[model samples]
Target chain A: MSIRNKYEEELTTVFNKLIAMCRTVEIAIEKSVNSLVHRDTELAGEVIKEDKNVDNLEHEIEQDCLKILLMEHPVASDFRDVSAALKMITDLERIADQAADISEITFQFGEESFIKEPFHIKEMAKLATGMVKDSVQSYINRDLELARSLDRRDDGVDNLFGKIKGELVELIKKDGRNADQAILFMMIAKYIERIADHAVNIGEWVEYAITGYHKIG
Target chain B: MKDKKQTVKDNLDIFDFTSDIAVNIKSLNLYYGNFQALKEVSMELKKNEITAMIGPSGCGKSTLLKTLNRMNDLVDGCRIEGSITIGEKDIYAKDIDLSALRKNVGMVFQKPNPFPMSVYDNVAFAPRTFGIRKKAELDEIVETSLKRASIWDELKDRLNKSALGLSGGQQQRLCIARSLAAQPKILLMDEPTSALDPISTGKIEELMSELVKDLTIVIVTHNMQQATRIADRTAFFYLGELVEFADTQTLFTCPADKRTENYITGRFG
Candidate 1:
């Protein structure tokens, strides 16, 4: 606000870095799901290895937010943006961990076909990834409409998770030998659902950044 | 005047007066000849609280601050309308004692403007003007004032030393001590630490938190961080208008007015 060019530029860098971290998590989500669907243990390993970078990015953005908070003492929308990013980064970091967890399950599948078709789980993962991407988009663009609309998409993930859980139960009941794989499938579905929940958290933070209110409406 | 009172009544919610208001400014408008410097400003400064006024240069924050103690009366062609009452007493009312008014409302300027005298004398100067000449009495007042300003231990051995010889931060504290010596009920500071280094600024800011227990402080500052750090409440002024006034945290995190948001976020033109 003092017409200081460097302060403005540093704030922009923090914002851009947060977006980059979001992009990294989105990529991780896609790769982790792909490794499972295609039964590629190598791709699954890559997703697990990439999680370290995601963790580091979360730390980096957090430090940057704190730097701006302490050095610049941002006010109003600038203050909101910094603090919202602080909270959003935590949610994003959790989402990254969920993606890694999914890849870890994919590694356990180990070149074997699913006991049953994983169509609903795949649909759930796809919907969750879409929510993550759109939430990040809303944050970077300060798109209120996009941020508010994310809650409805979360319901879609929830529905798919419910259906996946029921189908997994049916698979486990029909044959005792398929129990282990069926439980893994259920866990993967839960992780995807958790990712969607984290995306909704990011959406709430985006709304807070733009309007200074956490309530979705 | 009647219409101005009506306007203030109409916007009572916006003014948001608490029960213990020390200074109640009601739709005050100030001008310097043809140029308006403060326009229809109304706000209540709570008792025993530190309130910070912040805005860009020439935003009339200092203008409103000067009005608190009638410091602007010295400027030629300056005129004020409406009311600013300190504890139910209209500051501009006839038969008001200017010297007594100043004694009750002390001030510290941006630059360290200590008198060219010993540190003890600088602190005692104000009390002396009001007819306290005994050495023992002056010593007691000077010591207490310096202690309250948080410069006593540092300057205890240097009491008789020339105040002008001290550091800028010390000189500023010496000025604050001088104001305190008069036992003023309110202290008005205009960029009191703008000339000091960060460590010195921290000291004065710390001192402010302690001082507010006994004296209401109104500070005008260009530093938004300083406002957030020391002030309980913050008021943002823009082009001679009061844009927003709220608790310091709320004002900095989510100011209601777009103009306040723009100015605080550095997007102002």
Candidate 2:
């Protein structure tokens, strides 16, 4: 193959690696929460081990992004994509850290009764994880509509966080002994909400790749 | 060498050549006997702007330049059709005075064709042809025109020396000075610096950049770099038709059409 095709192929590989890493983290998040809610210590070990893969892929994609930027003086859309990809990975790696933070809480809550139903937590994970996937694909395809669609869904995640906060406050007031568990749950939901926000940041970057715009609320 | 591209008839409209413009052309065609050189060409030169005519040799860039001032009238079997105008004045009208129109719109050739006379007289010659006869007035016009052409300081003391004694660069400056002396609102330059060395070319470019603030200049050149550097806007002509007309930076950096990209990248000429 020609050198240009080879370079593009390598870039495609990097994009695939990032998308796969996002998927893995999404699954790990769901599995990590399941380990606590169902008292499945087996799933907790799996979540902890899965993080090594995220760390490895993150390192590999970061190195490749740097290589592309150094070698190519790409103009216009390609320039935006490479830059956005480099930045998106930083937030992705941090999301991985947040997922790990949620996983560590599983051991802390091992002995306690279920403080509340896990539906809201599960939904937050699903929404943010899907946003991460959609943003990466939108960027790779340069699909402005898809990027904008992902951008809008962040409002849903924010609303979910609000409902979680209100429910926790009422539960704590009803039983003062529930205070510690309620606050810990709120903190976990807060981290998940912030993960949704960082995913929105990635979606905005995708919009920039397609239309050279980064407008947001 | 002049850059040439195959002029696709359907694509020529991209340059948006118009005749209703202050400058008009209609069914304008040229030939060197049996060779129908420019095919049913119709276009215009907009008022008070630098219009660049670019194409390969024999595509009739020089033919069209000469046709403007009726310089092609000297060529054997060089037939012209249709009309060209400046505002309401149709230049091709029989009653239209060729000499007077040429006086109002002066020309500079590919080579620096300064007349073989004193530097001061070369500029003074065009005004004299139009009957400006006072010696004191002539001297004043000479100094002002030379200074405007940016060569007065270099040749101020050598005004009476033979034009041939000046270097090639100086001769081109003298040619520009001569054009300025005509006090023409429009100047047509046909590859005015292709013959000079690099320094001489640089001087002509500098002079052109300076002159355009006062007069509308139309230049025909093959050098893409020179066109990019000096023109506020550029029109790319190929095979007797215009391919693109855009801002200079747009034309050079990200040409809109495939043919423009090919030509600009030096894939073909």
Candidate 3:
């Protein structure tokens, strides 16, 4: 039997923790957007509180990577796994922070109706959440094709952000009275777009872990 | 930006034949009693550098090393086909002096096979074989060889003691000192550290790095980490064939051949 059996088990736990953190960030973004759509203040509060657990999971995975690096003297693919995990956790943490930021914006709107129903903004949130989930799935499964496809998939969220900005600008111009609500909706759209960008970054790290080359996209 | 780094790494792996080639073999084939030991093997050992040969057992790594100094000549029914040249002279030429060839190239074995004589005599034996009859010259050679091998300080006062009385690690170093006593231009070592502790292995590895400034070294080792640590170029042999040869870093991290990758990663069947 290989002596690396024990190290391999520890690595499996790190992989599971990364997936759990992905799911947490995915849930946070979903709940934050749902709260805004349904005017639920309690769900927004829950998302804001869940960010700490994501932070703790990131810390735990980082510690495991460092311990394996020091103890196992990993080479070849094992070396790539540890290094990719280190970079990946940073992007995962950023996604969690952006989710909390979206939840904060939802709290500001309170129970008031949005300037317009947030159909585009909610679509952007769903797309971004799917991206975060799929990117982590690509990493766990070592699916190079799925990771590469996320780069093109990121363009959808970016396009949605541009469309939201144009619509919000027109609403503000239609009446100076809609300026406060229009600007807040635009800020929420920007936060969801940022989450999609972080997911793209995670895909790039997954590619690096598999092939040792991170595409600039 | 990555293209430039990759180009530099590629250039380092290429062998520039315009410079000095210490040892060159062309289509070399060796067989012992109809069992092929080496098949059309050819490689160039760069001067003043350490080249490590690595593979599994009976992969012909040691057979290739032995051919560098014609040590396989003693084996019964061993027939070789092809030419090997050291410098400008063919080592297998009819008129070549065996003593001169052995003098120019020295070898260290797997085990520390120091003679049963005293430490001083062991170091002096190589020089005396070439007919240096003066006491002062022999004494100077003994001191300098021990110092160069990095064992002088430990054995300076114990020169009169038998080499067999030394520890396994110390005896290995003494064997290295004995090899250096001949002042050979090339050193061939077959698993020099396989029998020593890690600390002793580290010392020998350090000594090899220092020795490469003046001598060419070819080592056959089973330990892949040792090759990555000390060798500038690594040759991977498989089933009596020269499979891949490249700079040590490239060979380990991204070997060009799948067999080389499997062997180095311990996945070989």
Candidate 4:
């Protein structure tokens, strides 16, 4: 048994809650993108509705971190763990919000045919959701190497976003009537790119939790 | 907004960057008869800064604190090696004066032990023993010491009252005032606030912060939070060995040594 059994238990509970919150966020990104690809209003609505769960989980994890700080006054790696959890949750919550934002955009394209195939946008969603999953995995395993790799992986998502934007612009140039749907697709791609950025932020925080070196100021 | 940023920058500049060594302990080893208490401990405490020693019980933190003033010399069969120098003088030298050494390095114990005399007399006892017989001189020393300990306003009206009549917190402050009366260059405290309530502990912590501007302080504490809150630097001791010494912020946030990290994070067995 550990020396500080109760403190260890409380910290474990907070970590588990953070992992659960990350899972919910990853699912939101997946379902929101799926709703856009399949035009399923029900799944998009479900993504929007379930965001409340992610917010509540974020709140609970935040309170747990505060309780550990107030009661145990954790230091060293435990202090870093709590601090990183607090920071990572903000990015996770933002990712959930962006997922919901994409879902809200899904309501605008009601049964309309796509101006283009949205191939690069789908690829960007896949990469963004994968980054979120890998960020959470890095946190769960305290893998510094995996966390550091996320920044490079985000380049793939950004490139895909650029490709999708260029494709939409060229499609609108060919047919001016495609502007409205092309603009909505552009918005969706931008949201996916933002989701990947939030995932990268989570990865930076994970790196901080493991090694105490934050890449950003 | 520009003024606010400049004000913050000015406030941050108040930290003293020049470190003057007050006590330099070099390869110090202590033993009680055949049993070793401290093992080759070496550290330099900065002048006018609070350095806290933290470890589990029986880790020789208190033994090291006692060595600063040669208080361990009173123990039976206690032996020490290595040099502890305050400025240019080696404290363990054969011709060293124990009285002057003690006067230079005053100590406060875990329990507040105010001699059962009047509060005024308690503060004046050290000076009076050192031959300050004049009433005016004794009165001035007593008042300045009390004010330095931050307890003058409360005890000024009751100076003639017995030290035993004060509250636990007040008595501890009186004990500190008594130590200050000696005009010590370095003050050593062994678990000074472990016996007091939180409010009293806070007052003492504040007093230590205020006092460090004029005098150096070395405190041995079991309370890690106290070290984090008030110490400029902290030393972690374990099993009679000096494990790690670092600035308080780095030590508590991200200690370089794994043992130091485990100990601070409560993962040590």
lDDT of 4: 0.89
Which 10 successive residues of model 4 chain A have the least lDDT summed? Answer: A208-217
For residues B89-188, what per-residue lDDT tens digits would candidate 2 score against the true structure? Answer: 7777777776666766789988888788899899999777766667887899899999998899999999999998998888988998998887776789
- Measured against the true chain A, the candidates' chain A TM-scores are 0.95, 0.91, 0.96, 0.97
Score each candidate by Cα lDDT. Answer: 0.89, 0.76, 0.87, 0.89
lDDT of 2 by residue, A1-217 (tens): 2235655676798889878887887777777667767877777777877788888888899898888766754433445667788878877877877777777777677577877877898888788888877877787777888878875798899899999999999998999888888877887788788888878888888776666566665
lDDT, residue A130, model 1: 89
Tens-place lDDT per residue, model 3, B152-231, is 99999999999999988899999999999887888999999999999999999999999999889999999878998999
**lDDT of each residue in A1-217, candidate 3, tens digit only:** 3446777888899999998999898888999899888988889889889999999999999999999877765655666778888998999899888878877888788666778999999899989999899999998999999988888988999999999999999998999988988878988998888899888998998887787677774
- The candidate, 3 or 4, that scores higher on lDDT is 4
Per-residue lDDT tens digits of candidate 1, residues B1-269?
Answer: 54654443333212222348889999999999999999999999998999999999999999999999899999999999999988667889986667767877899999999999999989999777766666888899999999999999999999999999999999999999999998887899999999999999999999999999988999999988899899999999999999999999899888999989888888787
DockQ, candidate 1, vs. native dimer: 0.55
- Give the DockQ (2 decimals) of all models: 0.55, 0.07, 0.24, 0.58
Q: Write the per-residue lDDT of candidate 4 for residues A147-168, one digit (tens) a residue.
A: 9899999999998988888889
Runs with alpha carbons beyond 4 Å of true place in candidate 2: A1-217, B1-21, B195-203, B249-256, B267-269
Worst 10 residues of 2 chain A by lDDT: A72-81
Candidate 1 structure quality by residue, lDDT tens digits, A14-86: 8798879988999999999898888888999999999999999999999988998888777788888888889
